[model samples]
Target: MKKRSLLFPALLCASLTTPSYAMLNGCVDTTDADKKTAVYFANGILTSPYAAENMAFKMGIAYKNQFKNLHEDSSYEFSDAYNYSQGKLTDIAQVLQQKMDEEGVAGISGYQIYELISSGLNNDPIRAVLAAFLSTTTNAIYTDALLEELGELMTSASVEAIADSLMVNSEHIGLYEANLIAGKRVLIMPHSQGNLFTNNAVAAVKTRQPDWADSIDYFGIANPAALTVGGAGYVTADDDRVIGILSLMENVLASNLDNDPSALPSFFGGDSRSNTNHLIVEDYWDARLASRAVIDTNMLRLAQNTPFPLQIAGTGAIRASLSWGGQPDVDLHAYEPNGRHVYYRSKTGDDGILDVDDTSGFGPENYTVACESVNAGTYQIGVNYFRGNATETAKVTVFLGDGRTITPRELMLNQAEGSYGNDNPATMFEITVTDDGEGNAIYSVQ
Candidate 1:
């Protein structure tokens, strides 16, 4: 593995210190500034700052190639037709309009045909023609090439080597402080394939300095790692090709971990998305950035909260409760996988029940799952402010069947503003249940 220079040398100098294993053995440093630190790891096929900088250029070429292939396979001037249909007129579109006029189809606008095809009105002649034009453009070839490339680059050994290289290179630069006090904050930003390296690196740290692990926070962008535990945040773009490919790989990796452990690394466990600390952004670039900015601004509030534990009363069951300190009416909303909304109005469902709906003021509201209602699926937990002032925060705690307690580190309701399920409503976290063998159900945060 090759070590690369820092993308922003000054920023690196201000943030990191070389790891001192000797200091971890015995020594005390009480004269360090309490500054926040953040480290970033770049995405796949990119080993250096230079490679990462050229990503936009490479993506442009890849998209061009993809469009060219789509046009060639469809054989209907797909790009021009699609663009024209989108209300953009080019020289090609003008020529096509002239041809349409000659062929007695002049009045049929591209937008009209697009709507017809999109709405599944295939019986219409124009829609049928447009649908046929698009149906021939397959993504099979592109997917195959992408999968092959990822398979070659994303091996356990390669990932470990990258981790080792990053740690080794950072030695002289100095980041890790041995014998540091608790609450010394550090954030790791790993994008795409860097997530693989980051996970392994954290696992390595756990083995070497277990007590120091909690001080680090992981903020993964488009992560593709297996076995993500707590104390991490993730961001992914819906339209990113690398994210789609990695998601497919993650499914296979997760299955193999359960059925064929020998085929993978001994350190490999399961997918990272099943952890309470993990967060998913379903939006595209700009929206994703805006969401991240909000999170980043509230990092201190997120890190400082001590999670309250929710005690479980039975095996294979889930119970969640919300409580606040101020005079506000907060409601707990739990959505089961079967589209069942368990709330104040509809408490009982096939899977869970809302036993306590406290609306009076500063009270604890609760929801629990019956023994027979335990099932393998994802449950979404949220908080709705039924009636309240603009400034109030709610504390949510979840108890799972597997003896795991999940309390979100940052679930502030400062924007509640006496609203229901609008922008102010906060989805605390999601829990996913699966069979743990031995006829038991294991619940994990997703």
Candidate 2:
């Protein structure tokens, strides 16, 4: 297609004076647009609420613009790009590819709303053009959520058709499990619905392939509201294979939809079910707690291998996995006044892992940690498995605890689990940090 004719740069100068924040689409308009590309509000057929839709459009626009700017001479024209040279279009595609290489992650759930918006565009030629430009390698979990939400937007028959397709296709992750597994990969869908869906998906998978069920990894929810009684019910009814992660913030800030002024029920609405999978709902807790456990001043340590001291802090103690071999025993070390000190170690039975039945409140298990106070220096925490202390299987953390704050640096996992942490285990560290800190530690998934 020929690139659309470009208006003079002077004529293209148009501004959109609006504030932009994270919306359901994960994009927003912070400034104005060019004459060719107007920065106007797009309701996106009202699938998401106006606030959410507006947010998504703005975010999408921002993402597109960001990608464009990274390319050479990425100026916009009022008309489409068909009028431009093949060279220009190729450049645009290359730029998008570079972006995916840099920013696109394998497992993350924040883009759920964005994925839904992209799926919506799948039906629209213009929208599809933009989405294709942005997506180079798609995360299967995220893509599935968007697809399912889009299916719901389609006729009722369409939703049932998709469900039936999932029920029959043994190869595909069951709709329930696929969604939950996606949650495990991406931490953005951190809600009860996401968690419930993950758990249900696991159950569904077990029914078909019990052997693989153990292999399934669980990613935690980025949002705490996803695990509430209501949120759990919604996701369970919608998709029970996935599990949601809960944080102190959710336990503290989550309010009844009827009473909270800031609460947006529409944002929380989803498939509702009374019965739910009984696998376990501690992925989020584990994600948060594992990170939290690192924060204990006593748990801090410096790896013996590293040259520079790495400071590590976590959000909370991670809920232990039943699949986990046993409670991890760790050796804590720090630079005390004179010589290297063995501050504290994971007690024999006092394995640091929180049990599945622990209360969701902020208590012993919430941000549990075992730290060794060195005089004041750098250190690392090395975790050793049962009697096999031959070599450190995993270096769980490296940190410095000086009686002021507890910070853990590393987390070594035995194997990847579904809904275990947000898409990125590294990013999930933030959730661990915020769970105990003051302020708006929690965010909503678009």
Candidate 3:
């Protein structure tokens, strides 16, 4: 066979679909990925929805740049979605500015700011903590009835509601059911308000699938929690004066993370001002002038020691697996573009393989994409009824890695319809892959 042209040279295709965010063919294969990548969640805040996410994403880019500087950045991929607490910045800045105007910056005290916040909350410091919690959680869980139930004490009802705000969060559920449940190794990098979210996400994983707990790595920045919900290491800048105020109260922030040798003293009375000492990008993630370098270094170390999933389907660039409603038998099949067929007889294909073949009930029999590679091509994914309950519904979950999302399709296998065997498998879906001429894979699903 002659060599295929590298997708360079500005290739043109008249019939091409607009690069769909909804693309990808998931080939099922075996093994762990050598090219390790972690999901760095950087989300938008209420005021500037993209700002916090950008700041959070900067941490990864900063770390990646450091790795690039040392020539060790060949194998990692970066991604984002994180919410920010910039409103705290506004509050802190306003308070600190007022204090500095009354007395010089040197006269400002964290305890003073804490007093102002406490006074605003009717002298209940616990109300300040609850206010902080409500700031981030308002979008998720909020009700007038709940508000009426509030008091100076952080009571059992408030704790339960806060837990509901965290554990029942949609984003947290997505991370668990999608990536972690699929068996991927991930480092959930969350900063500031995001640390609270990540901590709760870690707890949900531990409760549901403790076996996968070690596979999930975490690194926190500017945590405002009393302590980490997960035992992962975290960091905060030395002169992050907003937290300086919160540190005076044990229930509000993780004061222990405030010690950063690299962080400089604040230029202002308090370091909570945006684009300055309190920001995640400027104060925490930057390498040459901040503690975030140490934070990133330790996270990388933690990821290095973090064990890979002992289970299959937990690792992949793309994946497809079978789970059925009723009895003990359903089969997943993938037809890779290179004419390689992946099924029971030939488990391994040129691109991916069938690593799991279950004859038991409610199986997560998975076909993970071969580590580090999801070849360019069309994949026809289908399923067959091998034995047992014929009236069962079979589900095929396609985890499209590389910035793609997960899609699960189900088909009711009526045994009377004769939908069993090699050639007669039900076609769950199809995915097409092509190069976008810039070394990036463009995927589309049918």
In terms of TM-score, the best-performing candidate is 3
lDDT tens per residue, model 2, 15-125: 122222211111112121221111111111112234433433433443345433533432221101011112332322322222232233343222332344445544444
RMSD of each: 25.9, 25.4, 14.0
Candidate 3, residue 217: CA error in Å? 2.2
Error of 1 at 295 (Å): 44
For residue 119, give model 2's deviation from the true position in Å.
32
Tens digit of per-residue lDDT, candidate 1, span 376-407: 66677777767766665565666555434453
Stretches of candidate 1 above 4 Å error?
1-316, 417-424
In candidate 2, stretches whose alpha carbon ends up further than 4 angstroms from where it belongs are 1-189, 192-324, 327-337, 343-376, 385-446
The superposed Cα distance between candidate 1 and the true structure at residue 397, in angstroms, equals 0.8
What is the overall TM-score of model 1 with all chains considered together? Answer: 0.30
**262 Cα displacement, candidate 2 (Å):** 18
Q: What is the Å distance of residue 382 in model 3 from its true position?
A: 9.1
For each candidate, what TM-score against the reference? 0.30, 0.20, 0.50
Cα TM-score of candidate 2 = 0.20
Model 3, 134-237: lDDT tens per residue? 33545246454554454422233233333233222334534444455454566766666566556655765565456677777677766655556456787766
